[model samples]
Target chain A: MRFTLADSRLLRESVNIISELVTEVTFKVSKSGIDLLAIDPANVAMVDFKLTPAAFTEFETEKDMDLSVNLENLKAILKRSKPEDTIIVSLDKDKNRLTIDLTGSGKRTFNLSLIDYDREQQKLPNLKFNAKITVPASKLDDAIADMGIVSDSVALIASNTNFTMKAEGNLSDAKVDFPACDDTVISLGKEEEVMAKYAIEYLAKMARGSKLADEVSLSFANDYPLRVEYNVQGKLHLGFVLAPRVSND
Target chain B: MRFTLADSRLLRESVNIISELVTEVTFKVSKSGIDLLAIDPANVAMVDFKLTPAAFTEFETEKDMDLSVNLENLKAILKRSKPEDTIIVSLDKDKNRLTIDLTGSGKRTFNLSLIDYDREQQKLPNLKFNAKITVPASKLDDAIADMGIVSDSVALIASNTNFTMKAEGNLSDAKVDFPACDDTVISLGKEEEVMAKYAIEYLAKMARGSKLADEVSLSFANDYPLRVEYNVQGKLHLGFVLAPRVSND
Candidate 1:
């Protein structure tokens, strides 16, 4: 399998977000695109990432293949790429390595050894969410960072008229409220007012996708895992599901 | 003692450079300016940093005093400052703390506890140098960074017609030469060619001062320690002395 990306920013961004949760992931490549579904080691979070052929300038594959990759190693190689660089990725079956070449002002190549992963692929869970909210990615990211400054966990509350993120600490408490009429709120729905708490660390890692997308969609049911997604129209899609942290109070 | 700086970039830059070599330093504050001279624990490098009253927008001091501080803590506070923020630094003698307030869109203050450093003050050494070269700080910084990619140490050679920096590793070698007529070479003087090798790590830290100065001056004699100096006209001055690494060859 071989593919070339005119802009590698999206690929790098997606890999960075997933690598923070899972160190190793199996990338399934086919004529359609590249897909990765992975659950973090602690089983507290899951990531669903997909890149279609439309997202790449040139993509080709003789046969479908599963390539187990060390996400950290791939991220390191991608970090060396410049904004104008075009990245080419190919599998070296004989050497059992993946070759990546970045071409821009200069061409730099990195050969990374592939690993054999034995874990079963994680299947996406079918979830029925009561509340869904779509907002600007920057707004969500900033809210999460503000909450992080106050506490290690934040509670997301969705009501008929508003959505809010709140965090409380020993010395400070922060809350960001977004009404349905707010420009940042693209859409909002609620069967009933729903509230759930999640670890801020995971949310922050997922929020990194804000750099790639202008808006993010969030969906969740009362006390259920939260789904954060960034979709670039028809080009690419990245989503993460984080488990709720049960609060004693 | 109290002072307000129109811009905090210089202070942040100075603290960052000093923290890389020493964790703690004693800052001597007087009516004229603030001065610091300290040697690393390994005695491989020494830093002499001074900021004149002219560097600050408002400066006032009732008496001269010595404030020992943890550079890491200070750096963390400075990292929070925005580019347009006005930095106000004041000593809380009653609490034995340093209060740094950054005022801009919003005011944020950090109260850092002062430590009692017991090390003896490092005095500046007076030595005659046979060669001196003044060049654009960016030019020198780029050369050192490029050399660092290939070797652990770099050789500085000053000749009558050219000044050069060279580094060699097992697989690769890099050299940057500046002819006397080059715009980067502000000035070069030498009775004979003088060469010395120093650890790249320390040189890289010193090079960080480039962000605060347009040009940097280098002075050394034979195999003696190299002195890297950044003088911002009359506002601020930062200098570093790095002992040469003895070559086995």
Candidate 2:
């Protein structure tokens, strides 16, 4: 299996995001471009990520590799990679080992044994998102931070005129409002009215993951699992699905 | 009163570090340059910071200004400043407040009232360091991180041959390692050896503070306070003197 990326930083960034939610990642590579799907237990959320050949620095894999390994260990090894480095990933089925080679300025390779991770067979419902918006990564990050200042859960609403995140905590109150009244960048197209509440902790983790990716594609339906997708690198996609926060009152 | 920095980030960084130890900061600017001295209560630590006009991006002040305000509040405002922002700090003596205006992509200012803060009178000692090495920031950062992996306190020993950090924990095991073996970039001009144990927690804080500045001047005498001095944006020379932890055994 061989994958090439122009900027090794992009691939590393995508890997960084998906690795956060799942320890083991499954890569489905074919002519239609590469696809990645990751889901945590409970099936309340799932991330479906995709990347076209244009985004890949290089893509030369004919077969698929559903490799699973400890994410924290991989992250530690990846931390040493330089931005200009060319990353080469290879798996030896006979040795049950995954090798990551970083080639650039200096050469470094990390080899780790792969574990038999049972890909969950749970069926993910065909999600019907009422709202979808392509907002900048920094805006979402700032909104999430303001949410953290207020409460453990944040209610997000995306409308035609504005996008708002509101949190009510015990002592402090915080709300991030992005009105289309001024900035021409953020726009809410038709059929974009969706309101949902999610655990601020999970959203925060997702935000951290999103920071490395260019822009996050948010999909949500009222009280349903929210889907966040990251178009990582040119050949990879990382996605996260999080359960909505249930309110008592 | 006016002072400018090559990088606004450096100014923001210096304020971030000074705010951690001292709540209020008194910057006494003179015709010669700028000298800032702050001493925390308990008389255990003091910061003596100085900067000359040549290093300043812009220095236009015929007279001196003894401006004192809450360092944390000032830091909070500086945090919002952009790296390219031209920070303008002024005194509104009639209003009894200090205003910091950051003008870059946008304009923002924070006005904080002056407060009376009692500072300890600390007499800095002139001690000759037996060991001195101008090591890279990355090398020092790595050494501190490695030592922290084993124990809470690390004893630094610098000699002509090597710069070593050794730590012994409550457990039977210990670690002694030098992050950099033999680098020509690291200068050991004086054939000297000095060993002093400092709490890893404080060392880590100092290391973090050192990140804002290029290199820190470390001064120490056995059983005495360890001093770290670094210039920030050539406008602030922040200093830190930490007391040594006494060994119970």
Instruction: Give the candidate number with the greatest DockQ.
Output: 2
**TM-score (chain A) of candidate 2?**
0.82
Worst 10 residues of 2 chain A by lDDT: A180-189
User: Which residue runs of candidate 1 sit more than 4 Å off their true CA positions?
Assistant: A1-249, B182-190, B247-249
Provide interface RMSD per model, one decimal: 7.8, 7.5
lDDT tens digits by residue: candidate 1, A152-192: 99899888778888776543345667777655452334355
> lDDT, candidate 1, residue A239?
94
Please state the CAPRI-style docking class of candidate 2.
Answer: incorrect
lDDT of 1 by residue, B126-225 (tens): 8677788888899889999999999999999888778999999999999999887756553444356888899999999999888999989998877889
List DockQ, one per candidate, in order: 0.04, 0.04
Docking class of 1: incorrect
